[model samples]
Target: MTCPLIQKDLANACALETVKKIVAEIGDGIFCVLVDESGDCSNKEHMVVVVRFIDGRGFVVERFIRIVHVPNISATGLKKALETLLSGLGLCISKIRGQGYDGASNMRGHLGCLKTLIKKREPQAYYVHCFAHQPLLALVSIARNHEDVDWFFCEINRLVTFIRSFNKRQDLLCKKQVSHFADLIENELMETGTWLNQELSIARANDTLWGSYFRILTRLVWLFTPIVELLEDLNSD
Candidate 1:
């Protein structure tokens, strides 16, 4: 009880005072809310809420108010928590002109999503998806719309996986890299034991991350010689 009171209670009290000051400065101003949920190494769910509003000088400012530990995340729980947080700071739900989510799969679902629930509580709070995902979505769209591009990615992804799974192939790849480096040194192209920043392993591409294809292509370019020799060695084995 002593430890929790000192660490948690005292800390929360200080945070509350700071929020009160910030809210007082934004009196009667319309603000937007940004919400993101994350989990730490202990698998504890945490919700972060930020408020973006125009200050007295007409400049926009964003301030992070609270990070609450939640055992689970649900539409109702999130909405209630958000309401309580704002009300604790003497803010009105109607002042929330917008709401934003990370556009993650869990939050994007049709049923009981955070953005949807938020709008239900405050109809004026418009939903805005994260802009960072636009490029990723474009890549996914291109892959889905084009058969050739899709097949190309699938084949490269499988090839990288297969190479990584085989110990002999990985050793052969390192050997080829060593041999190539030796030649470069012998030819005075680079210093002996020159370390190329690129590692020998083939890079794996994530299906959901944006620009992973570029990563695959870049790795292929750097390891072209060693990869070719490795393939030939595997064939002769």
Candidate 2:
């Protein structure tokens, strides 16, 4: 099928008109804005901003209204890009009811420059830190403070890497039901901390163990003889 003749400028103008018409028809509704920045293979940073709002029927819809190629991740650059995008959409920063972003240092801050500017403009705008990011930050904190825990994670990762790298080792581990056993072990391990006399320390130790349990189980099952010998040698020591 032959493609129809299309003019780029006319296409963009019509698209913008459609968006304006839709927003006008929707009337007043809470708008959720999401902003994020990413770097491409060429190492050029681009900022994308999206707006979501509810319609008359109370159904929520999201629209990608602006994508600006920012020079950098500086506060001034982000502010300029966001301001320009909002102005072009005939949106006041104050109209935004909710905001979401990947918890970048620039995006999720209260004292940092970006959030300060945003709060100054919209005092009631709700700010949410991405949930997935919060857990990752918590994990990183735990990993940083405990040397033995960090070592266990590094070793577990190395074991997983080794198994995944070799087709035979992965197949053997799967045949031994290591994955399923690891899942069961983790469930049991969670219960272990609840009845401990030294609850807090035991829980922390169990948390580290649970985190790396699967890798250790897979390694043990796949390399059973070596693991048994290592355990025996440790006992003799």
Flag regions of model 2 displaced more than 4 Å.
1-18, 25-28, 131-237
RMSD of each: 7.4, 13.3
Clashing pairs in 2: none
Cα miss at 184, model 2 (Å)? 40
What value of lDDT does candidate 2 attain over all alpha carbons?
0.64
Mind giving the per-residue lDDT tens digits that candidate 1 earns over 113-141? 87787777789988887666667777788
39 in model 1: Cα distance from truth in Å? 0.9
Highest lDDT: give the candidate number.
1
- What lDDT does candidate 2 reach at residue 59? 82
lDDT of 2 by residue, 49-117 (tens): 877788777788878765689996876678788988776767777687777776566776646656666
- Worst lDDT run of 10 residues, candidate 2, spans 197-206
lDDT, residue 198, model 2: 20
- Candidate 1: misplaced stretches above 4 Å? 1-17, 139-149, 155-237
